[model samples]
Target: MSIAICIAAACLGAVLLLPACALARSATAAPASGIPATGVIGIEEGQLNADYWIRQQSKPDATILDPRAIAAQNKRLHELDASVHDIEHLPARLTRAQVREWIEAMSQPREETLYDERGEEIPAATLAALGDNLALDTIPAEQATRYGMVVRRADLRTFPTRLRVFNAKGDSDIDRFQESALFPGTPVAIVHASKDGKYWFVVSPLYAAWVEKDRIAEGAKAAIFDYTRKTPYLVVTGASARTVHTPEQPGVSDVQLEMGVRVPLLADWPSDKPVNGQHHYASHVIELPYRDDQGRLQFSPALLPRAADTSADYLPLTQANLVRQGFKFFGERYGWGHSYNTRDCSGFVSEIYRSFGVQLPRNTRDQAVSPAYNRIDLAEGLSHEERLKIVKTLEVGDLIYIPGHVMMVVGHEDGWPYVIHDTTGITFRDRTGELARVHLNGVSVTPLVPLLFNREQPTVDRITSIQRIRP
Candidate 1:
């Protein structure tokens, strides 16, 4: 065994303990999954395939995420009043009564008073203006009877505009955010629109939010849903990739798509028809959407070079591939809720698994608590050493979840577990045994032991759950 895998035992025995609350559980329990199992360290690039999860989910009924669990969660969600940010597994078509319920939930002013960046309370007069501008009276419940599809990576903002807003001075976390992003080919029900008609309030299977009008295309109820399930599609496996540009159709040309976005290939496209003056066979001729002169969504064909970063199917869920896929975003700057033209912590992990056909909730809180994942409840009252021991057993793809953040276990070395995550900053001790801080405002790798949440609580102590997407 490599030094990394063998470091677990001696490492745990050496830690000096002082806290009483951390001693309730022992880390020595044989892992439920029999881990410390060898992972392929350097598989050839060509070998990344759907075979990754075959061994892990080998049991007859051992599936990926549990559908029965999701169905039950959806049933509970159905009872809650829907918000623009609430995730409800609603169908592609919502009945009129359902639409009215959604409208009522979204149209009213927020129950609590809102504050601006200056920490000044928003005056009641201003709140009234916001309410009036919401223009709830104009929501054409009769006209919004179809489905929609997002054709680009678009933000889901608190309000329907491109205006940038912040929480407070020195806090540029993009307060206009709604913890969700709609990627290409995501199906939605066209529920409502902004008064200005510039943004469409649509609902995905997991979330509902306002996406820019130009980024979405409304289609027939059946077509929008069918478009996503079509076979022979390619999933973007790289951080981001663009289609080969075609001057004749600039709208659909050079289109940019992020990781896990899937689009179907035009299987019947003839070889002789060249895109950008080259044989079409050399590229994956795929269908994409663009807005017509009438501002309605329409489909068009575009070319993505076969050599571009994509896959024939969702990558297999293997330890080696998990490491490989996680490294693809090694240096990307952390985007809060997909802000700063990049992805946030949850977005980073979500995209990695999406390339492998796994679906996850959009936020760390929900993901940590979701009943579908293979959850290792490390809630408080357990011994810290027991928690650290569980941390050591974490495999390459396991998600080590702290409140509001997540990290993927890439590997271990010298008794130190390394993680790659999208985070704003981290605190640790320097070689001189002095406290230090590093502003890692993007996706980065660091050891697990030295990390401190708020410079005091060991990250392990605050881990509410260690969620495994697949057993």
Candidate 2:
């Protein structure tokens, strides 16, 4: 029987057992009031399980795209998307004008009023100092491009400073300076540096932003790319994993590896040898990036426990695997620009698909408009009913874009489509038709139809596009 029908039958039995007076009192009880204690609405208890959604798929195990197909799609993305860069193929030298353009583009003044952590408005002089810190005048007429690899997970900032700014007073969850993050061993081109010599303006495959100098190590382009291209790597399949804590090799010890991060495996290592004070038998030996005292790039062996959630290769792109991968991050805190050792909306979905060897743009705006994927662009003139019709047709793993946020379709229940997303909060119509707001502030699952983009519109009416990661 359907879930709705089962719920109706249970309610009927409960009503029949209640006393007449109790029933009369219950009838007048307050309308299905505030958001549930769990901060999730429209989700049945059973819907939380990956198996529940997997069972709903007609062909859960069917491959969405084979290895060759995924490779072709990635190549097409690198070619078509302006936001994605092919750093390995960049020119050896950069002109002053070229470097200036990159710096000026990202250093634009903010139109909105920004407040510091103390709730004080940022002074005009302070903003000007930040602009000066860009050191655009320092760019040489012709300079050799420097290459490097991220030695650790590092924050990508909008400006060279580490000052945190927010849109509103007392609201500090979203840091405007935080652009994105880079994983360990990710290759990059160091284009410029802050006047303070503290941060580098780097161009990574997915983003270009200011990263701390200590988190990256200067290296030869060939050596950096060679390390990234090494095969027989281990793919992180869990929400996150960490290397064994080691005082002997602190550079590679206790390092956090997020989902989809691939590290080259030391496949030929001797079985009897210990790695950083740990036995090789209990762990997988992997080569990790390290920064020397002189800030030069180096490699060291580290131990990733065999019990950690990892795979020898990318997981097969299948419907069941999509549900399983997404659920691995369920309830993780929403971290803007991958802050808090977690991820935001786009990062959440990108990492899940990355584990399957599929590549996507790093931000929602880029992913939604990219021509690399099959997309359904929703016109502003489309009626609400028309948009709902399109949403109902979305298959598992399809991405739904609504302005700044994106959600992955999990499954359908009682004719309503459910989605999983990392978000700050959700708004929906309560029993009395009054809009109720819930501060979810984390990865959550909710039905799509009842959600509100704001008090003025439903989420369906605000969808800008839907992207399908398929041929």
Q: Of the candidates shown, which would achieve the greatest lDDT relative to the real structure?
A: 2
- What is candidate 1's CA lDDT for residue 146? 60
* Candidate 1 clashes between residue pairs 3 or more apart in a chain or in different chains: 22-383, 22-384, 23-383, 334-442
Prediction 1 TM-score vs. true: 0.76
Report the lDDT tens digits of candidate 2 across residue range 234-256.
99999989999989898898888
lDDT (0 to 1) per candidate: 0.63, 0.82
Per-model root-mean-square deviation over C-alphas: 9.6, 7.9
TM-score versus the correct structure, for each prediction:
0.76, 0.92
Clash count of each predicted structure: 4, 0
TM-score of 2: 0.92
In candidate 1, what are the lDDT values of residues 8-116, reduced to their tens digit? 1000111112122122122221234222211112122322332332233324222344445434444443444232233223444455566656655544555564456
Off by over 4 Å in 1: 1-128, 139-144, 276-278, 431-433
